[model samples]
Target: MKTLLYIVLVLISFSVTAQKPVVNSAKLEEIKSYLKHFEDNDALLGSVSVFENDKELLNQSFGAIPASRTTKYQVGSISKMFTAVLIGQLVEEHKMDLNEPLATYFPKMPGASSIKLSNLLNHTSGLQNFVVKQDSLKYWLKKPVSQQAILDEIARQGVAFQPGDSISYSNSGYYLLTRILEQKYKKPYETILEERITRPFGLENTFSLNGKTEYEDTAISYEKKDNKWVKLEEFYFPNVQGVGDIISTLSDLNSFMSALFNNEILKEETLKRMLPKDDDWFGLGIMKAPFYNHIAYGHGGDTYGTHTVTSYHPESKLGITYVINGEGYPTNNFAIGLLSIIYDKDYSLPELTEYTPDKLYYDAYTGTYSSPELPIAITVYQKEGALMAQGEGQSPFTLTPKSKHTFAYLKAGIHITFDPDAETFLFKQGGQQFELKKK
Candidate 1:
C-alpha cells in the first residue's frame, strides 16, 4: 500500500543519467518478457505502459482481468499530482499562495496559523494521516461522507507535530488541500479537475469515482484469499476524493505525466517547485522514486485491490506506469524488476510461488510480539480465513505464507520468520531485521 496509504506503498526514490537516454527493441523485448514471466505464473494482472518523447514503447495489458486499451483503474494517491497541479494553477493565476497560512483556507484547523499551504503541499504539515485512522475502523471508511465531515475528522485527529518540524505521509494534508481547491474555485475538486486538468489534457479515461457503480471499460479489483482472487469492495469514492481516489488507465496516466513534465500543464517554473528539493524525496504533489543512478519523478497509488505507479525521467521524456489489481507476485518487486531491465541494472524475475499455511499454524503465530529494538508491538491474529498482523497504531494486513512458519506482507515488503517453539519471530522491513519475542 504506501504513498500508495500510511500503509500505502512508498514510491522508492530513483536517480537518472547525465548521459543520453536509450530505448531499443531489445530492451522493450526484455521488459515484455519479464512481465510475461509474471503473467505466465498467474502472479500479476493489469497494464504496463512506457513512453519516450510521448511515443509508446510498450502498451500491453496482462492478466485475466479483460483490460482493454482504454480500461480505467484507480490510480490512488497519484490523484495528488492532479490536485497539486490545480493548486499550482491557482498560484499561477494569483488566486492562491503556497506560502499563505493554512488559516487563510481553514482558519480553525490545528496549527492553522503556523501551517502554510507549502507545509500541506510537501507533507511537512503536522496533520495526522486521517487514512491511518481508517485502519483502526474508527469511522465507516467505505461510507459516503460530506466535506464538512471529512474536515471534522481531520480536525479531530489534529496535528501530529508542529508545522515544518517533520514530514510524514498524511492524506489529511491533501484532503485539506482538495477542500481549498473546491473552496477557491467554488466547485468540487472533480469539476475543477475536468475544467483544469483532465479535459484540457484530453485524458478522456481519467476521472473520479463519481458515485457510479460501473464503467464499461474499467477493470475490477481483487484480493488473493487462500489461493483464489476475490473481488474487493472499493472504498466509497466520495469519502476518499482527495486522498486515495482517482481512476485512469495506464496510457492516460503516462500521457498526463508527459504533459506535466513537458509544461503542457503547470509552467516549467511551477513544476520545478513540485519536484523533490535538496535531499527530500517529496515535492508538492510529486515524489522521487529510485532506481540506481537515475531518478524517476512521479507517484505511486494503491486502493483496496488495485496497485499502481506512475513516473517519468523528466530529462529523458521517458515515462513508465503500471496498474495491477491482482497480484500473486509482489507489485513493488515486480516494478523494480521491470525498472532494472529497463535501465540495464542487476535484476531477477521473481520465482512466482504460492504458499498455503496450515490452518493449525495460524494459532501458533497469533500473539502480541514486542522487541526491544522497536517501539511498536505487533499483534498477530486470525482474520479473513488467513493470518494477519496489526501494529499498535497501524492497519491490519494479511500475511501470506512463504513456508509453514515464514510469512510476508508483500505489499509493505515485510517479512517475518516465526519460530513458534521459541515464541519469537524475526521481523524484517526496509532492510532492518530484528527478533521479536512473544509478549
Candidate 2:
C-alpha cells in the first residue's frame, strides 16, 4: 500500500511542476492567437518571445515568414539599449565621464561646449530632433545618412534648449554617442558593439553591422496608412551606426534584458542610474514603469517600418519582448498587458465610460488649451450633448473622461492626464507626450 501511494504522489508532483508558466505548446498557441488578432486588427506584423529569469519561456513568429527563429528584425530604437551598454562600458573603463560636457567628446556640435554627456543620454540637452523636422518618410525610404551629416545638421541647428531643463526624445543624442565611441575606441561602432557588448554577452542573434538582410525567415514589416496595409521598404544602411540602427532576434533581446536586469552588464550603481525616476517614462536609455510591487525597466524601439519593446522586472526577474515589423503598433500597451496577466494583475488602460458630463458642469471644461511647443490651441466644448476637442486644423475629437479631470480621446487613442499641482493636463499620443494648460 505504501509503495503504491508513493508512486501516485510522484505522478501528481510531476504534473504540477510541468504546469509552471514556461513556453509550452499551449502557450505557443496562445501567442499565435495574439499574433493573429494583431494581424486582424492591422495592428502590426512581427515576432515575440517571453522569458522568466534566464530561461526562454516563449518564442513565436507571425505574418509572412518561416524559420523566423533565426530571422533578423530591425530592432529600431531597441538599439538604444546597446548604445547605453556601450556608454556604460566607456564609463567603466574610465574613458568617458557621463557627467562631463558633450563638448569633451565631439567638440564640434555647435553648443557642445555646454551640453553634458548625461544630458545627451537623458534627452535633456535641448537638441532639435533631426528626423521629425525633416522629410523623414522620404529620407528613410532612400537610404541612411552619414554620421557626419547627422552631427553637421545638429551643429547647424544649434541646441534647442538649455541642458538639464526638460525631457525631449532625440535620436540625434544617441547618434552623437556613436561619434564619441568611435573617437574613444579608435574603432568603428560595429566593432566596439561586437567586442564589448553582443559577443561578450553571448547574444548570438544580435548584429550591429549592416549588410544584405536575410529575410527568408524574417517577419515582413507593414504599416496601415490611410486605412490600407503598406509594405515597408528598407533604406540604405544608416551611418548613425551605434545609435538607432541594429538587427536582432527576440532571443537576443531577451538575453540582453536579462543581462541588464541581473547586473551582469553594469555595476549596481550604474544600473541604478538606468532605472526610471530620473523622469516619468525614460531613464538613461530604458523605459521604466511601475509594475505591481516591483519596478520594470526596458526600452521600446520604432524606426520607419518596425516597432519593438522589451521589458524585465527586477524583483521577479520576469521579462517580455514584443517585436513587430510594422511601425505604429501598440507594442508598449501590449507588453504592459502581458505583464499584468503574468503577474495576475490588471492594467488601467484608457477606456470609454457611458457616463456623460452633466450639462451644468460641461462649461467648466470648455476653453482653449495652450501649450508653448504645440502648433495649435485645443478648443474644448460640448457638442451634441457630449464634450469634444478640436485644434486649428484638426477635426473635432471626442473625449472620454475617466474622472473629473482625467480624459481620453477615444477616437484618437490618447490620454489626457490632469496634474493637480500644475492645474493642467498632459496629453500622450503614440509615444509623443506633451502638456496643456487651460487658456
Candidate 3:
C-alpha cells in the first residue's frame, strides 16, 4: 500500500474530472457474474462493495461462509486516509497547521524542526519507514510494541533525506501523525476516530484496533501453500495504529468513501487541497486510480496478508472498495477486470488455472539480475526441482510458473517475465515496473 494504484499496465489516462455516469441492468448482471467468478474460482478471497450516489449496487463476500460478509479485514495503509482527515479537521479547528513543524509536538524526533505536517501527509517527509527492512522487523513485529519504543525506533531509523527533498512512502510519518492527533485532541487515537469520523459518519462497522485478536465476523488473512489455504501472520495491531491498524468491512469502507465524496469529512476547498492539484502524484492521503478514461481518487492498503483498495469518482459519485485476504490471482488483475466491466469497456472474464510444474530447464533462468531502478540485485536459482528467487536482503521464495519463462510468487505480489534470449526480466510489484538484465 506504500504505492497505491501505480499500475503500469492499462493505466492509460490521468484526468480527475467528472465523466458521464454509465450504468445498466445488464452491467449489473455482468458485475454479479464478474464477482461470482472470483468466489467460485477462489481467485479473490475477501470482500467487495461498490456504491453509486450512496446506493449500494453490490455487497458480497467470497471464499467463505454466507456470514463472512460482515468480516472486518484490517485496512492497512488506507488508515492513512482517515488519519489525514483527522489532521484536516484539527487544522480547521486551529489545532494544527499544514506547514507547522513536527518539532512543535515531538521535539526529539529527527528533523522535527524541518518536517512539516504537509510533508508527512504527502509523503515528502523523508522519514525512514520504521516498519521497512522486514528482515529485521519480522523478528519482533509479531509481538507487542510499545508507543515509546516505537517513537525511539523512528528516531533511530532517522531521516533518509532532507524534509521535502523527495517522495518516499513512510509509515513512520503517519504513525507520528497519529500521535500528533492524540496530542492535539488529548485523547486516544481510537477515541478520536470514533468521535470525529466513525460515529459522525454512521460507519458502525469501522473500528481502530488495539489488542483484541479475536473479533466476531473478522476472518484471518491467508495464502495458499501445499495446495491448501494457510493463515498468514500480520503486524502487531497496536504498533501500526493510525497507520495500518484500522479494521472495517467493505460496507463500511463503501460508506466512508461515499461520505467523504459528499463533503461530510472536509469542506470542498479543504478536500481540493487533499486531491491531486495539477500533476501531483498524490494529494494529502489520496491517490488516483484509472479505469480507462475515468479517474477515481482514494487509497490502497496492505498488511502482511490482506490487501485493500478504496476510491470514489466525483463525477459519477461512484465508490468502490475491494479487500483481499488472499488470492489465486493477482488482486490487481481482478481489480482491472472488474473496473473494465463496470465502465462497459471490452473485457473478458479471467481464466483461473492452477499450474503443474513443468520440466523446462530452470537453469536457463538462474542468474543474478541488477536493475538500475532498484538498489538490490535479484538472484534467480533452482532449488529442489523448483525455480526460486531471492532479492538482496530478502528471503528466498519458490516461484510458481505461469508459463515456461514467466513466474510469480503471489504471496509477495511479485511477477517476473523472462527473456532468456536477451537475459532480462520485467519485475512488477505494488504497481511499479522495472526491467532488469541478467548479470
Candidate 4:
C-alpha cells in the first residue's frame, strides 16, 4: 500500500511539471512594466499578445483609448503573407506552379516573360514598387485606382533588374500576384481569400478592405505633431489592394499563424516551398528574423500611422504579435523586448528621454562618412534643427541624440557613436558594427 501511494504521488508531480507555463510571473511583470513605460511616455499606442503553445501569456493594450484583442487594424505588408498562403493552397491543389512565368497571365507586362511566380513571392522580380514612386503615389492617393490603372503604371516602367537576378522589395510584384489570382479563379481577390484561406480557418476578423467605408472597432491611427497625437487623413485603401490592404485583429492573426504552422491550412511539402533560402532572407511572403539565439519567421508591416509585427518560433511553440496604431518609438524594440522576456533572456527597459542638441555641435558631425567594408556612403546633415543621416539609395532619417556623441535612428535600429578625437564613427545595427571615417 505504501509503495502504491508513492507511485501515485510521483505521477502527479510529473504531470504538474510537464504542464507548467514557460513564462513566469517575474518576467511577465517585467514585460508589463516595459510596455507601461512606453505608454506613460506616449510612445506606444497599441495592443500586444504573446502565446506559448495554446496558452496566452499576455494580451494587453496601452494608450488613452486602449484597443481590445478583437479591434481591427490595417496590417500593411503582412497582408502579403495571406496572399502567399493562398498561392500555396493553389499549388497544393495543382492549380498553380511556382516556376511559371507571370506572362502566362499578363503577357503585356514588361519583362513578364522572364518573371516567375517565385520571383514575385520572394520580391526578386525587379518590378518597381508603384506605391513608392512619387508620380504613382500622387495619382493613386488622390482617388480609388482600378486594377487597370495599377497594371498600366507597372507596364510603363522598365524592369528595375533582371528577374531573379537580385532581391528588391517591390509592392508591384504582390499587386500583380493579386491580379493573377483573380484571373485564375475568375473571382475578386477578396472572394478568393475568403473562400480559400480565412473562411476555412474560421478567421472572422481577417478580411480584405473591400466595400468597407469604415472599419468597426478599429483604432484611430495617429502621428505625433508638436508632441501631440494628430489623426492622419484617409487614403484610398483599394489603391494598395492585395499589396497591403488587409485588416485583422490580434486574435485572428494569431489563430491564422497557429493554424498555418500546425498543418491545418497547408501540407508539409507546400509549406516547405514557401520557406526558401534566399539572399533577402524572405521566403514566399514571410521573413525569417533572428530573436536572441532562436530564429522566428514572420512579416512586419507599416502603413499610414500603423505598425505591426507577428512572428512565431516553431521550436518553442511561441507566437508573438503586436500592432501599434500610433508609434513614436521603434516597433522592433518592443518586439525584441517582448521576445527576450518570453525566452528568459536579459532585456533592458526603454529609457525615454528627449534631447535638444545645439546647432553648432550637430553641424560638426555633418559630413559624408564612408567605410571601405560597406558599399554605401552615409551623408549626415542637419534638417529642420535635427541631425539626419541618409545612405545611398535611401531616404533621409532623423537621428535622435542619446548623448553628445551617441545618436540613434529609432526606425532603423541604427546607433552611431562619434569619436571626435579619432574623426571616426561606429555604426551599429543588428549586432553588427561598421567603422566609418569622415570624408
Candidate 5:
C-alpha cells in the first residue's frame, strides 16, 4: 500500500508539471475552416492573427493574394489606437492636458469653447464624422485637406453635443487629434507615429501607407463573387488624416498591441488614464469593451475593400489583430468569437434549422416589407419549398425557424419577430420595427 501511494504521488507531480495551456489544434483547424467558409461566402481576402500569452497559435492568410501578411492593408479606423497611444505618450511627457478645451490649441472652431480634447478622443465631442457626410475619397484626393482644414471643418460645423455628454464615434475628432499633435509637436501625424509608437516598438513593417509608393509584400485588396474574386482599386483619404488613415500588417499590429499592454510604451498610470471608465468604454483614445473577465482595448477600421480590428486585454496579456479585404466583414464579432472559443465559453450561433412554413403563410409575408431604417423592404418568398427573406441592399439569405412564429436570418445575425395583429404583421430587427399588413 505504501509503495502504491508513493507511485501515485510521483505520477501526479509529473502530470502537474507537464500540463500547459494549449490552443486546441483541432479547434484551430475548425477556425481555419470558418475563415475559408467566410472567404467562400463573404468573398473575404485578408489575414488573421490570434495569440495567447504572446505565443501565436493561429496565423493564416485567407483568400486571394492582394491582401495577405506580405501585403499591407489600410487598417482604417484602427489607426485611432495609435493616435491614442501617441496622446498617452504625450500625456506621460506632461506635454498635453487631456481635459483642456480644443480652443486652447487651435482656437479657431465655431464653438471651440464647448469641445474638449478628452471629448474628441472619446468620440463624445458630438462632432460629425465628416467621412460619413462628405465624398471622403473624392474630396480628399482632389486636394488633400490639411490639419488646419480638418479643424476648420469641425469649427465650421460646430459641436454635435456639449462636452462629455455621450459617446458617438467621430472620425473628425481623431483628425482633430492629429491636428493638435501636429500643432503641439511641429511634425506631421506620420512622423509622430514613427517617432513615438512604431520606432520605439521596433515595428519595421508598420507605417502609414498614403499612396506615396506601392509597398512591397503588401496584400492586394479584392471583392469576392460567385466562387471567384474581384480586385478593388484602393483609394486614399488624407482628410481623415489620423482618424481613418493608416496601413499596417497583422503581425506588426500584434506587436504593437503586445508592447502596448506590456507597458513598453506608456507608463501604467498613463495607461490607466488612457483606458475607458466604468460603464463607459471610450478612453484617452482607445475603446474599452468587455470580454469575459477582462476588458479589451482596441479599435476597428473600415475602408474601401478593407476591414480590420486590433485589440488586447491587460489581464490576460493576449491581443489579436485581424484584417479582411471585405467591408463590414464582422471582424469584431469574429475576434470575440475566437476569444470565446479559446476560453471554452458557451458560444451559441444561430442555427439554420430545416424550417417549412405554410405556403400561404409564406405568401402572406412575401410582399415587399418596408422599413424606414432599410433602404428597401425585405422581400420574403417561397423558394424550393423553403421560405427566404431578401433584405434591401443586403445579401439574400434563408430564414430558419426558431419557432412557428419567429424566424432568424442567417449570416445577418438578426431575428424577425412577427407580431400578428389581425391582418397585419409587425417585423422587428434590432431596435427598428416595421408594420406590414397582409398584401
Candidate 6:
C-alpha cells in the first residue's frame, strides 16, 4: 500500500511539473517593438491583447484614438462566433437542432425549406451573399433597414447553389439565424446576447448595436486618404445588425474566447462542434487559421474600416486578440509576427521609410507589361503623382518606391524593378521573379 501511495504521489508531482508557467519578457518586448513599427509608420491604429493560460502577456493601444481596455470597436464577423455559442446553448436545452431546416423559421426564404441550421453555421447553405451586390450598399447605407426589408433583399438573390452542395460564405444566412433566434426566444437580439453570454461571462465592454443601444467609448473607424485618416462611421455603421454589429474590446474578446475554449461557457461536445475537424477549416462559426507551426482556431472580421482577429491555440493555451480601427497594412502579418515572437521564431519588422520617384521615372514605367510565364498582363499608370499597377481582373494598387527603379507593394509582398534601357521590369513575389517586357 505504501508503494502504491508513493507511485501516486510521483504521478501528481510530474503532472504539476508539466504545467509550468511560461514567462519570456524579452519575447514580449519583441512583440511590442513589432507593433510600434506599424504604429510609427501609420500602418495600424488599434489595440492588441495576448494571453497565455488566461494570464495577460501584452495589452497595448496605439493611434489617434484614446483607446483603453474599455474602448469598444465593431468586431464584424467575430460576432458570428458569439451567435454560434448562443445556438449551442439552445441545442443543449433541446430548444433547437442543428439539422433542422431553415424553413421552420424563415419559410419565406427561397431555399429556406432545404437549408439546414448546420449549413448556415458552416457557410454551406449556398445562399447568395446579398451584401456583395452593388444595390445593397445603395439601400442599406442611407437608412436603417427593417427586418422584413433585409429578408426581401436576401430572397431576391435566391440560392447560388443547392443547399449543402458546396460551401460559400453568406451573411444572409446569419441574418436569417438572427431572426430565428428572435422568434425562438421572443426577445430582441441585444437582450438575448446580454442574458446568454456577455452578462454571464462578466464582459462589461461587449454589446450589440441595434441602432438604439446608447454606447460610449466606442472606437471611431478611419480610412487612409491622401496620407490622411478619414472617419467612416457616418457612412458605414447602418444595416450591419445581426450580421456584423457587435462591439467589443480586445481584452473582452480574449476573455470570451478563453472561456469558450476552456469549456466554461460551452459543453465539451458543443465546443467540439464549433471547432474545425475532419479536414474542414470551418466548423460552425469558428474556423481553423494556421499561424506558423501552431493550429489556431478563431475568426477574422472586417466591416468598413475596422479589422479584427481573435484566435486561440488550445495546445499552447495561448489567445491573441486585436482590433484595428484604421488599417493600412495587412493584419495577418501582425498576427504572424506576434505568434512568431511568442514561439521564439525569426521574423522581420516592416521598413517604414517612404520614397518618391520623379515624373520621368513614372513616365518611363507607364505602359502595359506582360510576361510569358504570367497568366495576366499588368498595367502601370500614374495617379495623383503616385505610381499604380493593376493586374487583369484585380483592383489597382499603389506602388511604394523602394529605390530608383524598384517598387514594392508591401501588403501583397510583390516587388517590381524597372529596366528603363531594356523596357522591361522584373516582378518578384513569393520568392520567385519573372521578367516582363513592355507591350
Index of the highest-lDDT prediction: 1
Error of 2 at 255 (Å): 0.4
Tens digits of per-residue lDDT, candidate 2, 293-314, equal: 4456777666656667777766
lDDT of 3 by residue, 97-119 (tens): 89999999999999999999999
RMSD of each: 4.4, 12.7, 4.6, 10.4, 10.9, 9.0
lDDT of 6 at 296: 74
Task: Rank candidates by TM-score, best first.
Answer: 6, 3, 1, 4, 5, 2
Worst 10 residues of 3 by lDDT: 1-10
Candidate 6 residue-pair clash tally: 0
Q: Which regions of candidate 3 deviate over 4 angstroms?
A: 1-10, 14-19, 64-67, 133-135, 212-214, 355-439
Show the colliding residue pairs in model 2.
none
Task: Name the weakest run of 10 consecutive residues (lDDT summed) in model 1.
Answer: 1-10
2 against 5, candidate with superior TM-score: 5
* lDDT of prediction 3: 0.80
Q: Pick the winner on lDDT between candidates 2 and 3.
A: 3
- Pairwise lDDT winner, candidates 3 and 4: 3
Q: Write the per-residue lDDT of candidate 1 for residues 1-439, one digit (tens) a residue.
A: 2333412234444553345458789998888788778777666788899999998788888875667778888888888888888899999999888889999988999999999999998989989866646555754557877777778888998888998899888888998898888888899777888899889889998887657545677787887666567898877777778667888889999999999999989898999988998778889988887566677788888777788889989778899998889976677777777777777677766655658677886788899999989999999999778888899988787777788788987756788999989999999998889999999
Alpha carbon lDDT of residue 383, candidate 2?
Answer: 73
Candidates 3 and 5: which is better by TM-score? 3
Query: Model 1 lDDT vs. the true structure?
Result: 0.81
TM-score of 6: 0.85
Error of 4 at 310 (Å): 0.9
User: Which runs of model 6 end up more than 4 angstroms from their true locations?
Assistant: 1-23, 64-66, 134-143, 232-238, 356-360, 367-385, 390-396, 428-439
User: What's the lDDT for residue 250 in model 4?
Assistant: 82
Query: How many clashing pairs per prediction, in order?
Result: 19, 0, 0, 0, 11, 0
**What tens-digit string does per-residue lDDT give for candidate 6 at 1-439?**
0000000000011222223225478777777787788878877788889888887788988865568878898888887888888989999999999999998988888888889999999888988665555463533543566666767888998888998788777788887888788899999888999999999998999988877666889887786655667886532333655667888889899999899999999999889978878667779988887643456788877776677888887887888888778867665666666666665557788676777666687899999999999999999998898889999889788888888899888656789999988999999986899999999
- Candidate numbers, best lDDT first, in rank order: 1, 3, 6, 4, 2, 5
Question: Against the unseen true structure, what C-alpha lDDT does each candidate score?
Answer: 0.81, 0.67, 0.80, 0.76, 0.65, 0.78
Clash pairs (backbone) in predicted model 3:
none
